[model samples]
Target: MATNQDKNHPQLKFETKNNTVNKLITVAYFITIKYNPDHFLTMFKKLYNKDQLYLIYIDHTCSIEVKNMIQTYIVHLSNVYILDSFYLQTDSHNKYKIQLNAMQYLLNVSAKWDYYINLTDDHYPLKSQYRICEYLSNNKEHNYFIYYDKSRYDLDTYNSNKYNYSGLIALKEATFSESRIIPYMSNTWLILTRDSCAFLSYSKQVDHYIELYSKSLLPSNSFFATILLNSDYKRIIINHDQRILFSKSEPIELILKKIKSNNHFFIRKMNLTSNSIIDKCIEDNYQLPLMDKKENKNELGLNNNQQN
Candidate 1:
């Protein structure tokens, strides 16, 4: 159902201070959703751009009606795709595998993007797409993820399971290996460069660690950081994911205050109602004046307000 117009949509570009023109950094985003189809669609609409790519994985356990609804709604979007291959269980290791599979699928779909971002249904962007692209364009070489050395935590009795593997043993089995890759834990969210994405998607060492971590508890927390930290990509890694974690029970007004005070690009655990409010807040704070808007319109030859 994709149209020629969708395929030929104008790419986003910005001019540098030295008067050179450069393409705005394009992002490939993969989102995993399990429930609340309507909420997911709303988030998708807010984040969608024809110039970028989106791959959605709906948990197979989700109802058929919910899955069909999401599919039918995004059917015409050329840049949006749904992963329909296999069921993803709630197991921790399965989540790690799903991320790896999604990254590989994205590499097969397009190699033009500059970055890869993974999100869940509860996440929402705090900054506009233009702002995100602009920031990334400025900092293209760095990868963003928050990581901690495994030695920092006392894993003695943590999330123990019937496998009877001691926490230390599980950590070793999950991350450490004969290659001497030091184990690290990280938040699941990440912002990785295209090269890092390719490395994680196709590298042999990454595959080895994937197999090594197959049975480890909460491998998703360690797999990516471990791989990147032990590789040459470690030099470009930035320890911040640029996301604000918010509790659903928190007041929206306080959340708005925190958002205005901080420079995070996204927030998580937001419901639809709170998301709408935050969206308005971003618009008000970042809205350009009429003269600037006119100049941008002339330069880009497209309405900045247009959404997919």
Candidate 2:
């Protein structure tokens, strides 16, 4: 009973055998209105491993048939959970709340994980689960995020002509705030530490701040970054999310070049209609050595720790 996907990509059947790393990572995947369910399923199948947990959230606008299809695809996987449908508006103005809700849910359900990563359904892994786990394990305490500093750029760059505030004002407001806490620009996807998630989930100040900005535009983009950068976790922020590459569809050659040069672990907005892109990515990534052993030892300062 092998399906077209199963027959075409036999390696997916051996995800566990291929992923020998032991570190645990949790993922929260948010789906937009336009994603292909089949592509999303393929992405999950490729990244699946016993050491990780995957939470999927579908936009409320999607039809019940779509949800049922997603449910059927992932129902058999013990590690994958489908969240209740929520109004995940694609409008830039209304996106913050949905992202926050997904984050809040992940934090509540899987607080024990070492690291948690957020991704959109359009994203696909550039590296295998073992490689991603190895990278995170080597930098156990560091959080990966991309943020812009106000010193180099003006605060007004992220704001509107009508209003300007010092911090997140509301989820849909047109103004931008220069947070003394930590002024950062907008990039939603990030990887954070478990403790950071706990702080965001439980901190009274964070709760109050979020309440104030509940109506603010893109609050999720800045709220967590502001909290982490303004707090004790500030120094540990890595300022880079290695899992994603932002370029739109370029030839595979250029993408490969970027991967080697930048150490990217994933890329987004790939063509869902074709498997050639993912096939090439997997072939190239699998041939590359897992994170450099010596660098892991020197960077993490472990005594000959072995990854199976």
Candidate 3:
């Protein structure tokens, strides 16, 4: 079991505001990146907040140059940490282990954060940090992720022998005989509460499931949802992950349209090619000086009217 540490870590210190409305809801972000350090840096700058914690994992497959580049960029930021000891191919069940490690590290690092969010290098924030924190503060009790029972399509794909897997069959058989726990699937993206994160990080049941799913195909996709849904945490589960998924084949215009129509906080699979769209999203959602200037202008008008 992971022990909760004091809010003030000797290495880092964050200020707590007295005003509830102005208080920032701190988030611990677990980020996994393999390639494209440039794109990762861009997203990192946008998401960086002194109050939040970022634990970044660079895949072992990446070159040393890539690793150094990332390390150099975030070296000065106390809140940002690179998980230099962890090296895993994120395409497999190792992704699940990486997240577990991050959860434990985050728990030990500080007790001040309210939520944990996992992201990848391909992801970009649809809203500013302030906006995301505000929304999370308002919806503190809810956990966000998309989950459902195994679909026929998924079963067919797994059973088709497209990938080598004796583990999936064994897991299904074991679950069938047990009748207490069943398999569940979901996307890797999640916004989990600190309590839920603690449960996942330290539970012995989670350790058992880790052993069971170690050889299963795409364990990262199934592991988190299966545990949360089958546990008491299910009561706080919300089906939406608050993220927009995009494909490289999709038209930029259509992608922008979808982003505009949706209230999602983040979007994934973004690359340098989509810089224009990313810029547009930032312009619209980021709490920039332009936005503050506009608000100030409006406030001045209100003040004049009140004086009159």
Candidate 4:
């Protein structure tokens, strides 16, 4: 049933689960992978449940045969709804646009879910889904979050930052730009409320801002966190955003100790390809690193999507 996307599936609208009213946690996985269609699915299946809704988007860069194979497999599953058209997120020239596009697709498809998780094809949750579901069902007051401030680390000058693409102009803009800019950082992976989901729904100015900044930028995800924290949201608390590093170049044990030193909740930007990353995260026993979020929450519950 899979035709060339441009041939017959030109107008692509991936269908989500038919209904969603009782599920405790709904995770939207918008992913673009380099190879092996099942590379994404294999990771997803280990952490997800039949009750949790999945709206999958594949890239057209893959062979139609491969695309068909993935689509056929996903559609047959009850909870995993198959999206027909595969878009290209691999082309370097359009990476930013396609990444955002994938996210938008996931958001629209997930219009009927509760919790929304944005993850890379490589991200896999280490925590037990049941444990997560139980915790979320019981505690409904906080926002899941993570943040880093290059400004706080004496690197506000920009030229010294890791990628060095951002510089004095960016710093001045964040400090005194008419936009009243501020800088925040995160690992790009996140689990957020439907409220946060709707809040992140792209607006003209927001998208414009993103387009302006994301061009030629190396770490778009880091900038996104800065934008969100500076926004009206207040419930965000610092959760660990580092996947425990096993690269001997950086000590994983020391980093875990540093993370636990702060008591943060979640971590990200992990080599989810590795079995050890999941094992390391679980070894922490759910004792997360964290920071106070009181200064951040505000009139941010935009009342955006009402009847999902």
Q: lDDT of each prediction vs. the true structure?
A: 0.68, 0.58, 0.68, 0.49
TM-score for each candidate, following the candidate numbering: 0.78, 0.74, 0.78, 0.62
Tens-digit lDDT track of model 2 for 1-308:
01222233223253555676654454434444346666777677777776676777777777789887776665555656666655556455545555556567766666556777877667777777777777677767777777654445544334323344555333223323433344456476677777766667666767656654455445556656555655543226666666545455567677666666436667787764566664565566653544532221111212433111
lDDT of 3 by residue, 58-167 (tens): 88888889877776666656677767545557775677788888898889888888899999888887766776777777766677887766633345213213264433
Clashes of each: 0, 8, 0, 13
**What is the C-alpha local distance difference test score of candidate 2?**
0.58
Off by over 4 Å in 1: 1-22, 156-170, 173-179, 248-254, 274-280, 286-308
Model 2 lowest lDDT segment of ten: 293-302
Give the residue spans of candidate 2 off by over 4 A.
1-14, 23-34, 90-96, 154-179, 233-235, 246-252, 272-278, 287-308
What is model 3's C-alpha RMSD? 11.7
Which wins on TM-score, candidate 1 or candidate 2? 1
Count of clashing pairs, candidate 2: 8
